[model samples]
Target: MVEADTTLAQVLRSNLMLTGTKIGCNEGQCGACSVLIDGKVVRSCAMKMRRIKDGATITTIEGIGTPEDLHPLQVAWIVHGGAQCGFCTPGFIVSAKGLLDSNPSPSREDVRNWFSRHRNACRCTGYKQLVDATLDAAKVLRGEMSIEQLQFMIPEDGRIWGTKYPRPSALAKVTGTCDYGADLGLQLPEDTLQLALVQAEVSHAHIKSIDTAEAGLMPGVYKILAHKDIKGKNRITGLITFPTNKGDGWDRPILCDEKVFQFGDAIEIHPGPPNVYFKQRVAKGEETEPLFAAAG
Candidate 1:
């Protein structure tokens, strides 16, 4: 049983613990939480528990296939390199399953139009592989291709390059059995503290004070950590690529303490002291001229 305000995505993920249905942009702008409701694809994040009709057949990514007895779509996804990072794979797979269930012989354009219409955004794999995978899955459903054909063979030299050997985790990813970061919450202790960021609203300003008394009074409010709460230097110290950074690597603050440098800056931290960490001089002249000079 779920509250009226609970979204279908929340019901599937939090209540039922069927985390295969992912939630990205929970406002429904992103189709990451897409699932099938009575064989029709719908963004689960947009669906509310109260709005669901009684006895309506809801199909999440888990219902489509399994690690054992994998679906054609999952196999094709592995072969076509359809998912990288795999956050958006389940949504696409569910959407594609819905399409193939209705129209088994959809063209590439049809697949493209369907994803475009549904706004199934993917940050990885460039999307071409998704269409390719879906098309091949359609062929398998239509009996034009065998599922075994998707398997890659190891060459005599054992060089897997240029071959389509699926990643060890690919099957889990496509089948929605893989555990992502958000899914880790299922295994976390009930008393574990969850963190939320409090960002700076203005681009630049001296932080007079952050009033957390009202928020601290709210129930279940464990602790409110500010810069003052940090015992050590509240900075991200590392010169990743900037060899000529003024503060070496101590410039970037973990939490902005005194002044806000930009909007959305984490509320604690500040820039480092004014001193050139590294300096190099390049002289342009004849063969006798110094090509390089350094000062630190």
Candidate 2:
């Protein structure tokens, strides 16, 4: 059973108990959930668990390195103050690992671009420190530094734990022993249903009439929630102000009613074999539209 519309952050957090993968935005815009899928850094928030269920191997911060046998990147992160608030550290570490794994020796500009996709950060540290740390760690990983020399680089004050020049988790991270949120066994109930939002195609248009009769009759669709189906509150949580002047903002139901707020706004929730729904959407060319829009 593949899971669809399942955020990798949630999979890492709730299922695997890998609290390291922080859920910054719960949206793909933030790189907090960045992880390595087949050695490429990807945003976990936007990735559907079902899409990767077949054969893709995921690498989380934990998978990259560990405290006992840290990857060089982890060491760099600690010695260089690349981590602060520690929320975004895991994702950054994993991303850096992916970059270094491919490039081994990256320039400053390369480092910046490697992290270009990540917009979130901690107040304590800046990108320069992270870049410097990564460079140093790369030197160590590439066998440029001897263990004794690496140890000598440590400060006498011992302010940092892994600052002795080598990251404690570097080896573990590179070896793929560390585990993160998504690695845990989700083990959801057999009957537990998965859902995905089907949004409106038009932007800035009031919905005239919705034709759900055909969709509702589909084989595996459990329920089609409309604005009227909401019993409690319809507003989206975490919003400070209602911009649309639409009821409490929560007034928007789980599904759009007569008013469609924006293009790609959820109009329907599909529950069934995730692969089937995904295939159907792809077959209808909905999947390719976004790519074309982005390219244009």
Candidate 3:
């Protein structure tokens, strides 16, 4: 059972343990959480459980294929270098599946038009590789090309460079089985308490005061640990050295108690110019500064 206010993406990830449906830009701007809803691609993040009709079918990346019996699109994605960084790969594949399902004989321009209309964006590898892979997958689906022909084989010369080899994690990524940071975090023990930082909102400001009383009363909030609750060194040991060979003392703090230098900053920088206390003097024979000449 899902909460009425919970998003479909949240339900899929938290309740159903379908981490393949990423929760990116939950406002529906990024298509990372895309899934097929009733045979049409829909942003899962923007869709709430309350809005879903009964018995409506949904298909995520996991439903598309498996590692052993991979879909043609997944195979093409690997061989054609369609996935890089891999975060956006699932969305692209799901969206592509929707397009291919609707129009299996789509032209190259049609593929481009489909992606543009769906707003399936990929940041790592350019769209050329993705389009190429989609077109090739379409051919395979049409029985014009065999999957074996598209599979990569090692060169006879034993040289792997400049050859098309699938990325080591490509299968996991394209299949939506790869565990990203957020995905791994979900596997932690139920007793694990999540930490959220109370970051500064302004670029620079003096912290007049902080009141955690109201927030502490909120249910499910275990504790609001302030800087004062810290046990040992409240700052990170500053190892940075100046040109004069002096170590910067306590410059990098673990928590800011007094002031903030920038937004989301936990450490406060010392006021004034950066660590270099003295101006560098260029040494020329006799044209150098009197201090440098005298030192020589």
Which candidate tops TM-score?
A: 1
Q: Candidate 1 vs candidate 3: which has greater TM-score?
A: 1
Q: Which TM-score value belongs to model 2?
A: 0.52
lDDT of 2: 0.66
Pairs in steric clash, model 3: none
- Which lDDT tens digits does candidate 1 get at residues 108-135? 9999999988889999888999999999
Model 3 CA deviation exceeding 4 Å by range: 206-252, 257-259, 267-296
Give the best candidate by lDDT: 1
- The residue-by-residue lDDT of candidate 2 on 65-164, one tens digit each, is 6667667777666666565445567777888888889999899888888788555454556678778877887888889974344333647686666544
Q: Tens-digit lDDT track for model 3 on 155-243?
A: 89987888897789999988999999889877877456555466678888887887777666545666567777777877666555455
In model 1, the Cα lDDT at residue 192 comes to 61
At residue 253, give the lDDT of candidate 1.
70
In order, the Cα lDDT scores of the candidates are 0.79, 0.66, 0.78
